[model samples]
Target: MKKIQNFFSGFLIIFSLFFVFHSAEAGFFDWFFRFFGKNEANVKKEEIVLPKYYRLGVSSVGSGTVIINVNEGKINCGNECRKIFPEKSLVELTAKPNDNYIFKSWSGCDYTPNEKCKIEMNKNVTITANFAKKENVVNSQQQSGSHSSKIISSSVSQKSSSKSSLVSSKTNNSKLSNSLSSAASSKAPSSRSSSSSSIFSAELMEDVFLMDDDGTLIDSDNKLIDKKIVEKFYTLHPQKTYYDFLSVFPSFEPGFQGAFHSIVKNDVKGIGGPQITSSYLSDSNKLIGVNFLGFGFTSPRIKTEDDVKNNLHYLVHETGHQWLAYIGKEEGFSTATHYTNWTDTGFIRDGQQWSDVMGGSPWKDNGDGTVSEIITNKQGFSKLSLYLMGLASQTEVPDLRIVVPENPQDQSPFNVHVRGEPKTISISDIVSRYGTRIPSYQTSQKDFKMAYILLSKKSNPPTMSQIDAINYVAKYFPSEWNFVTYGKSTINSR
Candidate 1:
């Protein structure tokens, strides 16, 4: 009985202790489970994240429309424009001028005035497309003017208004026109005579070759010799005999300064071509001509077609320096000409600007010692260069227009008004014009033919007539051909 009582007493004590502990900390175990549940709820809330977006704004001044494109979305802003885009999106903006208006400049964007603007959308951005009315009276006045008048028109736009006003003065015009005509005529005959005489005909080139024989410094006629003879003479006399032969040619003499010679075995560093000047000074201290020691017209060994072609190429390239000097003096584009380096992808030579070739693209050098046939065969002045040099008339280059798509994946179309009619050209035609093989990129003939068509479609505008745009894609995006052609049906089609 006593043992049973003791057991009951011990049970009462344990029960009392349990009751006290439970009452003191009520819901302790429930709270522990709820803490983990709350942590899981917080994690789920973190998983529900928000996306990021940015704003793009565009506007225009004058008679033009601003076309803005982000991905597949497009907005045509006549006066004001705005849109939202994902971060790091590339937006293409184009300014289209109305009839009788021209694109002047761009503001609030990184782009040339007339060219297309490519923007990378990182933050809220605004851009403006500026335009101006095409001057009709000024254009007419330019057409009727003499060479001096044309120079004034091209070089000094600010003074054009006053010069045009002078055209209306009939009393002054009669005297001015007569004096200008007489002066122009007198200058023309002498200049033409000098150039015609100085031109190196095939026969003259051969004659000059004989004169340089035996490094005799001077020929029997007392004329300074060519290449090695000149080099020998220059070393002996330095200044007195240097460039004496070039003085007779007025075309080469106007901007003549001096030359540099770098002889490497039988070949010259730049193939005996002139190192074109980057400065536009009427009198510059820069090296204008270059002579290779061994490669001269005197070498009797250059009889093959390839040899003749190569020599002619060197002659043209060297003479190009003289033309560049003359162009620089009139148009102030001297700094645009530059030497060809391996990295330059564009056709514009070093130191020359875009307009130097009338927007003609730079020719790429094939490692096998051949350039594009279009460049070599034509061997003519660029349309813009011709205009600057007074070689081409206004009618030669009509209202040229290029239409680029809002998306790079879209087809860019180009149109030119010929005889007041718009002519549409296919991608194949452009490729044909450029040739099937690209020497610079070492593109295979088959690949270039296929890629040219595909790239023409993938171009930002999908269609472009501007030689600048055409050459840009052909040169810079050679690798994107297959992706744009077979991977997708159209540009940005994916």
Candidate 2:
């Protein structure tokens, strides 16, 4: 009977042990499956839904035709134009006027009356290209006969009178002209045009004045000399001044005024040097500033005519800064043209951290102290710098892509690709591919990693497209990235 009781107790104990073990194992399996299932459900929930696309309509007025070019398709309209294009697509329209007609303006489209019009098709858009008949002023004048002749004679007389006034005024300053003419005649032929003679004379006078005065020669302001005097100086000393060459012509192309300014102020070197401050028009982005750096001067010890001629490249470098300041200010960046002290390791020792010249090129002081050589003459402008200055054309700029590996755990390298314009990809797509948190300024680790990767992969000077991509990332994303991101430490910390 006791033996029977012992067997029953052992069986009961064994049964209890088995029940506990099975329960624990089942609980663990349930929790594990639940966690994985939750993740899978989230993945399914995040699926992307493409936006609905709509058509764009284009038309023309008068004798002109409208040619619309979109990423998806192209439409040429002679009279009434209509086409279908994807929503949010960029559309470029060109106006071609028929014979005896000229392009007038664009209607029903938010664009200036340029030969080309560009817009983003967010919804159904209708644009009209207008043209006007070209008026034959010459034919009208001929028809008028005697009256037209009188008007023509009067116009010629006015022009002649203006020319005579200019010549007479210049002749009044005969002392200055004669002095310069004598110096110019020594170098070249005496039988030169009046304009040529004036320019040569100015050049000689500038050289003489620069040599005669010490570096302490200060005009009203402590910076340099007066701009009028400087202009006259450049006119006389046209030998090496690039500004003189450009100013001799009527006007500059759209974006070359900064370049002209740089040429004129290349040799201006005194205690203060050149200083620029910009102010914007009320309620507009139009930038206006008094450029005090236009006058050209130099240190007495360093004021050799040869030194001035040799440093012509400095004008190019400095002009680049002016362009940057103007465009950057207009684009809502800091008005300061030069990089701050925090940005550059080597900067002016006078507690001023401004970049010497957009920090584009390096200037080395010759031990002789006559002139400094801008070493990076071959490297015109960095891609980032060019874009900021509005010098990069649409074709020159490239699209940006952040490439990821198939396996997140894989030790393979990641990269930022700068190529043609990318197809419309939503932010959710980026998050899914690159992970929930993409590199941003807020995420320092990810931001630095991406920046270093781009810096390593970038071309020596970088392309305009590459720079554009970097800029987009910085401006839109959380990164405070820019052209100086990688080279800040290496800048001369003088």
Candidate 3:
């Protein structure tokens, strides 16, 4: 009788305390409920944690306009503009001057690069876009738009949004759940979705790369850059879903010169993405988007501007892998992702080659029924390669051929003589051999973008010279591509 009375007294104390402070949570509530043979804890006042939000104020000191681009929307700031965004959200602001005005500078931004400003929202911040009248210029055709969608993720995300941003929770510190709730004065995006899975599926690994005020997914010890950092960079871009290809340039050696890096983490196909197919190995059109990662090693290989310029062919060759190399492999005619060479039985006459960017060299049409390699390494795309890249229709692709040598020189494609017969293969033969590309030029992506980064093995940032060298590659890639592709396709790397 004494023991039973003491147990009843303890239960009453716990029940009374639980009801008295009903707004707060306590494990004793569940502990006492167990005595009543109740399996459910009867959670009445479950705690909920909210995501952090911040306010961004934009102002202009001169006569100009500022276009602010967030997750998927753009805001035009005439003179003053203000908005609220969630933490870890990326904001891009571009200044477009009036007819006679010119962009001067930006203030209160992280850093102004290529005449644009970017801000990562973590706290209440203000930015000023300034402009001034042109002094005496004929027509200031100054560009005023973003160059690349490079995402700069902040490792430290626990920063405060406001002073009273803390939430009340139990002692156990239960897992925090965050939701994209409505902000007090936030303008919701009307066009873009919160997720990018509908278009670019990275084996559903997109969320793993995203961040919040709660935590970040980036893992690194000494900040050695790799595909993870590169993937994260593209995953955070505002227009990630709208893009067809996401190219990443690292400063480190990836063992190979370049590649159309895949983002799939498993063996699932059809949505594997880029340089591979979603359905089968034959149907390459199922892949909608891809990631291309490349690197240029320093020294020995590249000591002068000419060497860097010459090594460009290697990078371009790998980029062509997005839709090349396999075109003639199955037919036993084309070389390894390139045109048929001396090793293959396919041969060409002493005539000018169509496109040698992928392979083949300019041959000197010798009068004695033999062609010689005048200069090696053709700089532009072949008509067939262009057709595969979806930049040209099959009707535009003409016949192609491979020049064979008389005296086989140990299967090497160097300063040799093209003194053998020619194997002339028409575009129809290729199309008949290896089925036509499904997503025709009409539906294929024509414009592409790339993000250039200086990856380092150590935590130290890249030197100014290293950055300039990589940037030099970025600068020349577009024009050279245009010259090769006959201005049909556009590529931008900035």
Candidate 4:
């Protein structure tokens, strides 16, 4: 009896406290909540973190529309990509910081007009949408069955608005629940619905590589020096070394194979092209066997004049290839130009965004290299197309067969090669002019090192491309490759 009475007394005290707090106009809880509400309402803004010098943009390809919503570290795509049989669309997102976040895609494939892309929402955030258009849709699915239907995932939280209302359990976290609920109720897309089973998905991964804030993707690291900074010595004095105006671009389907094979043959010593991709294997498996150029040109920073120049050059060059791919002329041996083919009308006109640096020019016709014709020459173009069709392969660079020819014997009299159509050099010729010994370069000459070092220590070692650049610079300019002694000031000037 005594225990029961005590328990009842305690319960009564708690209940009375709650009732008083709920009703009291001047209670601590009431005053505290009121103050908080007033402050929150009065505060008209929130702080947004941005890079010192960074830009973010979106580009759409094909007949698809893409809407990206960004807020407080959350991102979503609305109807970004929808596959219409014989009609396809593309949407791209580019970010500068090397941070991790979630991405959700609401894609409508399977030719379902009613099936629109949706987003899973979480937290208070803002989002923007962009769209791209294309000509008549064609069903190339039969030929490219190897391709998977691109999907925008729901790696982040998402919510969808539907005609028939449905209820979802309130999340335990009140703030997150409220944000998600608001997003779902705010807008029902002005699109139709379908029974398609394709679902939106998202995931958090390492920062995307070789993608500029401008949304361009590059594939090589050679651009580091050429794109980062301009060397005053090279510009004024012009000491011609083998690598003057060399510009390397990422190859597409067939071109990718040729480029891969080039690396395997010239860079990766001992690696044989035949062993790279066996015809008996599937296309996806073949990629694994090839010496895919490590994604190098994707570094976000342009530290020097060379970097800016090279990056811009490579950007336009690779974008040209992508442009070709966007159109139907990706496979055939057509000249690289800004001209568009209106086959239906039997006319070809210059593309609106075409430029000489991109398509074909005088460089494509005459150059010193064996595969001359711009980098888009017959050989380069042919190799790329063949590689894509699994008709060719690129192995890793083997160490054994690097050939160093005598300087005087080589055909090209010039020791250095500068920017032009396809920048290249004979190793024998460069070594003779630049000397077998390393040159006097400074560590500051290469800026991506700092970012690469930090990322490597925090994550994986510098990627293959990073390693190659370091090796090349270190071998030719040993004094410049300063060891970064952590927690000590022995080598660092900064």
lDDT of 1 by residue, 131-158 (tens): 8877752322232332112121132221
Report lDDT per candidate: 0.32, 0.33, 0.48, 0.24
For candidate 2, the lDDT comes to: 0.33
| TM-scores of all predicted structures | 0.20, 0.22, 0.44, 0.17
* Residue-level error in angstroms, candidate 2, position 96: 64
> Per-residue lDDT for 312-374 in model 4, tens only?
322223322321322122321122232121111011113212113322212221233222111
- Report the Cα lDDT for residue 283, model 4: 29
* Candidate 3 global TM-score: 0.44
TM-score of 4: 0.17
Report the C-alpha displacement of residue 339, candidate 2, in angstroms. 4.4
Instruction: Please identify model 1 stretches exceeding 4 Å from their true place.
Output: 1-209, 212-303, 325-336, 339-379, 388-390, 394-494
RMSD of 1: 25.7
lDDT of 3 by residue, 1-494 (tens): 99999999999998787666753554554655655657464645664343455667888665556778765555555456566677778888998764346688999898799569988987778899888876654421122242111111211112111111112212112121011112111322122211332111111111112111111322333222344453454455534443334444433334433355443222211111234324221132222334444434232122234434555654566566566655565444455456654422212224533435555544444566565444322356766677877788889767665565566672444323445655567778877765667667787666765444334332222222233344345545666766666788776523
What would the TM-score be for candidate 2 when compared with the true structure? 0.22
**Which segments of candidate 3 are over 4 A away from where they belong?**
1-227, 234-241, 252-314, 330-332, 343-355, 364-369, 376-378, 404-415
Pick by lDDT: 1 or 4, better one: 1
Q: How do the candidates rank by TM-score, highest first?
A: 3, 2, 1, 4
